[model samples]
Target: MMTNSSKSTLSRGITALVFLALVFVPVIGSRAMVQDLFMVLTLLVLALNWNMLAGFAGLVSVGQQAFVGIGAYAMFGGVILWGWDPLPAILLGGVAAMFLSLPIAFFTFRLNGAYFAIGTWVSAEIVRLSVAQWKALGGGTGTSLPKGTTKDMFGVPQIKDLLGVSSSAAADALTYWLALGLAVVTLLAGYVFLRSRMGLGLQAIRDNVEAARSVGVDPLRLKALVFVLSAFGTGLCGALLFIQITRVSPDAAFSVVDWTAFVIFITVIGGIGTLPGPVVGVLVFYILQRVLADYGTVYLIVLGLIGIVIMLFARKGLWGMFTEKTGIELLPLRHKSLQRSER
Candidate 1:
């Protein structure tokens, strides 16, 4: 009988080793490989935040793109208008998203279930349309970061000094490291939260809100906390994403599919409510993306079909199926006792 803490410690050790290895990936891997992994890490962060909110908090939001767009636009505005360093602006973008989420939460919290979902989506659309009219950011047309500004992104100079690389190479290295940090933070934070007192309360609410409230869980406060936290991570990811692209447009910044839809697909297919689920799901998604690249929109159709099959056959998701077959928890949020004596 190994304790959950022992298991978590061992897992953390292994994860640390893996993280160390990844830190060196940018050193040996080609620029393209780093770039591709950036996409994976970014999406994984988005998926993790969404999974935490929906899977743990029972707040299924479809309008997360609003925060994503706001984050990106904030970064762009900071760089273009405020003349701030890109790095600090990225942090500001997250702050801006957190602030935006407050009022939206106050409004959307009034609705429940499906109405909440739709209200969130409508809020996102309104934001996209409003951002589209800001002529300074090229209004509806879109704009790209000047080469000078891109090259001068804060930390670029320091990174160049340390790595002895060109500006473009330094940029990639810096962004790759940031992506790596964000992904790790998301995973650790989610796991920690799920193992916390609030995590227990949230799980109770997930199972039965009335029961949770009866026990003094304070469902509204817990839900609001989760919502604000989700906005922060999503907004940070959006800023990092647009930083890589070095350009922004209303459509691209506020893209529902890229920011929200794919995230949902990854979480749902991976096994909602499990830490390893999103990680495995993102890997599976990338594999499918590579294989189905030439098929155009058919890849999406196939995703839908797979989702339906999973729902019908294994409602808990692929990781859930795996867990049912073998009781292994890569990131354990649930405690178990094997023997009655131990119990």
Candidate 2:
């Protein structure tokens, strides 16, 4: 039987191999494959951020779409209105989302449980409506990036020259690589944060607010930090996503079904509190999407049914269930006891 150490080593090896393969995909893979994987990576980023907030921080916000929209719109503003490149505009989107989260946290933090969720959704709607009024961006009609904007992005030409690919393909590769980097950074940062002292405090607050307070945990501070950070990540992802598509509309950017509900489904299906849950959930979701694409609304119904089944049978999600049954944790959070000799 493998010990916990051995299991961890094995898991790390497999993860490294998978990421290594992913990194080279843009080089050897077709343009279509790169695009598909880009979608998967962006969804994975959103799922990870949502997991950190709802799963660990105990902030069940249903209005995360607000940040996505804010970020996308901010990026669009940077490119069209300010004449900045999309790469730097992505950072602006993240910063804008982080700032928007402050007011959101101030208000929604006052609510609890179901009320909190509803408050967040309402906040998102307000943001959507407000953004729709920005006539310079085409008001409710939305707008598109200038032609050749992406082709002329900073890294596109270098990628095109190096890979001997068309400008469009090069642009796709650059976006794909950026998405890949973002996913990696988000996952690693989440893992590190979850294992830190503050992370333990956040989880403690989630488990019992009063008890955590008794132990000197600042629930509000920790919760606010997570909310802002998650917003930043979601915003960055949104900007990157729109950059690839080179278009943005308020309705499309802030769609609850696409940005929030799907993310929640991914987190819940994979194992909300576990770090690897989103990764596993995204794979399952992608497979389902591919298999059910032709069935229209039936695809959504199937996703709902699967989510229900998982919640009823395995509330901890697929990754949680696997760890429970196999006693193998690829990413264990619990600290092990020190041996007497070491002590």
Candidate 3:
């Protein structure tokens, strides 16, 4: 027997889960438009993780590509070196990134703002150089994984009937689903933590370190935890990206330009410090890309101009503008309830 409060919470959880499950139906069930949606979902997940780090934690880490490259490399290393399955390898990659983040955090945490950002970029460059020099893992030339490695690693039995995709496509689909799940989980985790006592401390610290410390918050520990988790999330995104390409090279794996640029753009364009902003931004950018994909360099120039214009005129990002104008929010990070609860 559940109390009314418990029942209400359960219902909401169920409803959210059902909605998530529905997102997959069109992809796995429908034939014409599944792949495109899956790709966009993957980008959305990337944007969400970036938002958690830069938007929420106020850590502008340019070397997020470090974790991304590490995760992709870990995928290959785990399967080839340890015979671990792909799914577990992906998780392993995330864990590895988290552990690695500790040392990086220790050093960079001493710096503030722009210096911290520069430190991250320098660290990623070091990683790229090291990987390029190392010959065992194929280095700058990159390496390839066996076909069906992702499916085989995850061990999804009845892949075809269950997913309604061919074996080759199934692997990609599964990776997309994994990214989608992580994005939702990351969002919920952020919301839950923000609502918890610790979240209050973090927010306080973000606002003013001296004030928060006077109130008994440990800024260092909180910042470290967020940095570690941010690395883990970025690494997980990288692993999914590796699954999509089925190949890894130092150049592509450590491609800061793509992962970092896309995520940073999405976070800034959507709304910094807001949960739903990055997701919305990703959708807008994806649509713009799809519509102008064939235009090549011209498309990129236009996007750059739009971004510049937005930065100068509307610095709050797209979601911030939407909130200011319409007051409608599909994802709320600051509040616990979907809508503002009146006392």
**TM-scores of all predicted structures:** 0.94, 0.97, 0.87
TM-score head-to-head 2 vs 3, winner: 2
What digit string (tens of lDDT, one per residue) describes model 3 on residues 1-343?
6654465466568758966774665454654355566666666766777777777677888988888888888878887777778888888878877877887887788889999999988888887888787676787897888766766655455556675656766665666567668877877887787777878888888888899999999977877888888789878878777877789899888888787887777777777677777776787778788899998866667667767877899887887898677555544445466886663
What ranking of all candidate models by lDDT puts the best one first?
A: 2, 1, 3
Q: Residue 141 in model 3: shift from native, Å?
A: 0.5
Candidate 2: regions farther than 4 A off: 339-343
**Model 2 root-mean-square deviation:** 1.7
Which digits, one per residue and each the tens of the lDDT, describe model 1 over residues 303-326?
Answer: 888778877887668999887765
Off by over 4 Å in 1: 1-14, 336-343
What TM-score would you give candidate 1 relative to the actual structure? 0.94
**What is the alpha-carbon lDDT of model 1 when measured against the actual structure?**
0.89
Which structure is stronger by lDDT: 1 or 2? 2
Clashing pairs in 3: 86-153, 142-249
TM-score, prediction 3: 0.87
Q: Candidate 2, residues 300-319: lDDT per residue as tens digits?
A: 88889988998899988999
